[model samples]
Target: MTRRLLLSYLGLALLVLAGLEIPLGWIYARGETARFSQSVERDASMLAEVTEENIEEGKTAELPAVIGEYAAESGGRVIVVDRKGIVLADSGAGSAAGPATRPGTDLSREPDIAAALRNQTTVTTRTCTEGGEVLSATLPGSSGTTVRGALRLTYPMTTVTDRVHRVWLALALAGACVLAAVALVAFTLARWITRPLRTLERATTQLAAGHLANPPDATTGPPELRSLATSFTRTATRLQHLLKAQHAFAAEASHQLKTPLTALRLRLENFEPYLDPRAHASLDETIEEVERLGRMVQGLLALARLENTATTPEPVDLDAVVAERVAMWEPLAAEQYVALAVTGVPAGQVWAIPGALEQIIDNLLANALRVSPPGSTLTLARAPGTELHVIDQGPGMSPADRERAFDRFWRASDSHHDGTGLGLPIVRHLTHASGGEITLHAAPGGGLTARVRLRPAGPPPRRLARRPHTAAPSHGSTSATVPGERAGG
Candidate 1:
């Protein structure tokens, strides 16, 4: 997490640097170039005016000397060309008195001179084969309507290029230094964000391992992580309290229900033979009610154990698990004259507690069998990724009933038999403990379908020992009576 946060911060810093530096460098380059151009333009115009005024005053002899002085002071070159393209005077080169006269010299071949001849100003860059570099500017010199001459000036670009290079190097160095500094700051900030998250993670691991007393320090890290720590601490406290209360209730209730169940079983045993046929039928109903209560108490105890369980999960083949349960429950379904079916077993397995998994499946199947009609079908199947589903062709539960189905002691009023009502609740608790969940919906043939999704098992610690199928006993002793077979009775 700290590495991730640091990467994120550095990425943002690079973005900000790119956004700032590129455009700023371009703007600085343009501003410096423009200012240099303006200075050259001003000096070129001044030189041109000086030559023009001297020529009009009939002081042509002094023009070369005056232009040469200005060129030397400005660190540039100056040349005078007449309207007939004659190179009359030169500043850097010696007096043009030798090869100075020019006519048809084709001065128009030079871009800046041509522009100046056309009464427009021009600037250009050219490299000197000599140990120097220069930028040239040309401006027209006019007396009244007639063009008298062209004034050309050359400014050295070496100084400007050197300055630009220095500025760029400085900026690059500064950018590197800034990036290094920002990286350090980003690492610090990232550590600040991630340290508390690491603590929270360790706390979560401990909580999962059943060490629920200790909580993370909420005052550490950033605001969001700190808030999360506070929330986890509060949640752990509440959960611990609730679990203690539930365990106490389950233990107390189990103790209380034991006496009633024992007394009810004794009474039913005593009344089994003494009463007439009608009285015997009522006694059977009472005995069934008492057994249902006993089952509910057992379910409560199972749920209580789940609440306090600290056992780590292990790998189990869910297909074989569901298959075994189906086989065990088949006789019971047959006795009720319900068609029991199985489908969709995958070769995969799941990580779960074995007992919890079995109890969950049993409760789902038992509930479905209780509500379904005699000829109705019960389907047990495995879905994708180690999920088991138990479905029945019975009256589908309403939305409200489905929502409340997992609450302890929940029972539909339409149920025909006496039920413990804690079956679904225990199923839910055990499912959660095994890192899975169960959902119920209407089956295709107008019945309840309970779908269980589970986590796939990892590799096992050792090989499983093979056992005989009969070793896994069926739930009931009597053979199933088909629905039609009992119609004549």
Candidate 2:
């Protein structure tokens, strides 16, 4: 983290240095050059006027001395060029004697000379190999109608370039100093920004781990971070309240179920004397009812625990779980002469709470078998995505019965076997908790099919995409193979 922060600081510093220094250096260099060129142009124009005046007065002998003195003081070269481009006088080197080397050359071809001949002063700085190292400008003057000439002046640019370079160096150093200062400030501020965030992370982890003894300190960092700490404190307070309530409920529920179960067990012991068939049937009925009540109480306690416990999810194998449950219940189905059939039990996994998938299948099959007639088949099939269907050819319910099947303690008819009516309710709750669903549908062959869709524990098998189906016979139907196909009562 520190390395990243330092790198970020250096990046910002370089950007600031470039932004402040590069353009400033370029402008300084251009301005200094422009000023030096303009100065040379002004001096050249003044010299042109002085030369024309001296020549017209026929004081040509004084011209060279005057021009030379001006040129020396100005630190530049001055030359008078005649109409034919002949160097008539050289201020820095005295008069040009005999035929000048550039005699009879066309002055019109030169940009400054062309402008001067048009009676306008032209100022420009140019590099020339022959004219020595100088910045030069030109202006035209006329001593008479026959003597038109140009006054050209040149000043060396080395001094100006040196000053510009010095200014550039100063700017770059100042920019570097400023960048260093900015980087220090930014580093300190970034640390301040992330410090509160780190504290908040630790606090949140503690909260998730059930550390409820002390709340996070509210007085830390900026206003936003302090506000976040306050929110965590409030949320922790609420969780503590909820947990207390859940504990109380579990304790109370456990105590309440104990009395009924003890009384029922004692009552059963008193009914052992009857050896007649009627007395045996009565004992069986009472025992079944008591057992159903016990199961209901157990389910209620389990559901309460499931509600209160913090459920950390893990992968579960739906198909294997379903098959295991079916194998366990196979003996019961066989004793009743009811055919138990299972299909599409793939060797795959799903994501659910452990034991939830088994419980769901058990409830579904139990309900189907209770209503089914003897010799009928109980079918179970698993589809893609951890989908399980327990279809039974039992006495199917109307639409109203289907809707209220999951309601707690609901019963469609009491003429059938005694049940706690909590089976479907528990099934629904467990399914929801496991992030799955349960739906009741009419089977294709006219029985009830309980479809259980669970979250896949692993990726689906990459094979044939055929849809799986399982069919079973109806319970209490006319074509029953078993003799005692009595409706469960």
Candidate 3:
């Protein structure tokens, strides 16, 4: 950005200098040349008058002396030619002004001299062999319309060229100074504009990290950016306070809500033995209701904690987690007389929040196991992409139910009444938080298939410890059911 801005400034400055200085320089050059030509022409006319009478009278002895003095003072060559096309006086060998030339030479052959003999004056610049360029002026010395002689003056054009060169050099120096000044000013302006933008960017990053210690410097830069910074700061302050209150509420409610419910469950259970034998069924049903309510609270609290925290994703071995979870759930499958197995090609590492993959797989397997018929099979499968499939040979849901499966407390019409409906919502929250996606579809052979798609991760470092291939028996039996399979698959 700074480079672009500086280049724009320099470009505009260069154009302005070219527009103003080029024409001025050209005009000065032409004017200086014109003045130089006029000077020589004026002098030629005066010299013509001086030698006109002498040449006509055919007494030219004093002519050479006059030409010599004038050429020495003016650094030019002077020639006096008579109307008969003969040179009467020449500033050649006697004067250090021009090449050696003898008197009585025909001068009318020269273009300027021929013109002058016709009673015309000519002024022009031309190339010369001895000198680079010379300005020559020829004026006729006529009396009463009769041409007596001509005076021809030749001066070097270097005098005019040198002045024009100096003017161009001066313009070049001025242009360079202007460009330098523009560069400095442009650099300052660029930095000024971008500094506040950088500040806002850093502030946004820190805000997303949930640790914005210092907000943007809204005191500097353009008014628009300053206003943006100020508004962001105000909003961030309010959001931080709201999140703090929510965290505190979840923490406090976790303790307050769990204790009383736990006490109530124990109270209800203790009365079971004292009740009449016929009332036992009612007591058991009440106890079950209390337990279900407790599970709902736990699921809700889990969601609250998830929402309040931000965790970065890390690489997890996809195949290893699937294997471990399958083994862990195999015992329950055996008890229910349902087969649990892993199928499909091996999936490699995938990115997920820490501890999230384990929870996601456990919940999905639990729900699958709950719905499977006694002779049915529960499969944890993988395919070409970075997606996992939990397919069960159980009754499948309609498309409408599948769409609303992620909604809190939503359940299929045929599902068990005991379902708390929080499971699928919890699963969704975890999946989205890890930057992955979850969807439900009908399996090929008529069963519900829950598919999770996640980002692939780079291979783990060789120096890292290897994960065990199988699930350890020490894992809690709670791994068997995804929130009692009440969790949505």
Worst 10 residues of 2 by lDDT: 477-486
Give candidate 3's error at residue 230 in angstroms: 3.5
Off by over 4 Å in 2: 1-30, 39-80, 84-103, 109-111, 114-120, 124-136, 141-148, 151-219, 264-293, 307-320, 335-337, 349-354, 373-375, 394-442, 446-489
lDDT tens readout by residue for model 3, 1-489: 668878988999999999999999999999999999999999998999889877677668999999889888878888888887788887763232347568889978888889999999899878776647888898999987999989888888877889999999999999999989988998898879777788888888887766578889899988997898899989998988998788778757865788899999999999988999999999989988888777667666666666666656778898998888787778878988888778888889887777677778877776776778899988888977889999998877888888888877676777775667877776776677666799998999799889999878865322211111112323322321235443343
TM-score for each prediction? Answer: 0.63, 0.59, 0.71
List per-prediction Cα lDDT, in the order shown: 0.69, 0.66, 0.78
After superposition, the stretches of candidate 3 with alpha carbons farther than 4 Å from their true spots are 1-23, 39-118, 122-173, 222-228, 270-289, 393-404, 407-417, 428-442, 445-449, 459-489
Using lDDT, give the best candidate's number: 3
On lDDT, who's better, 2 or 3?
3
- Rank the models by lDDT, top first: 3, 1, 2
* Backbone Cα, N, C clashes tallied per candidate: 5, 5, 2
Better of 1 and 3 by TM-score: 3
Candidate with best TM-score: 3
Q: TM-score of model 2 relative to the true fold?
A: 0.59
Candidate 1 C-alpha lDDT tens digits along 95-132? 21122334235565667776787788888777655646
Candidate 3 lDDT for residue 300 = 61
**Candidate 1, superposed: residue stretches over 4 Å from native:** 1-85, 88-151, 156-159, 197-214, 218-235, 263-288, 311-313, 343-348, 372-377, 381-400, 432-437, 444-446, 453-489
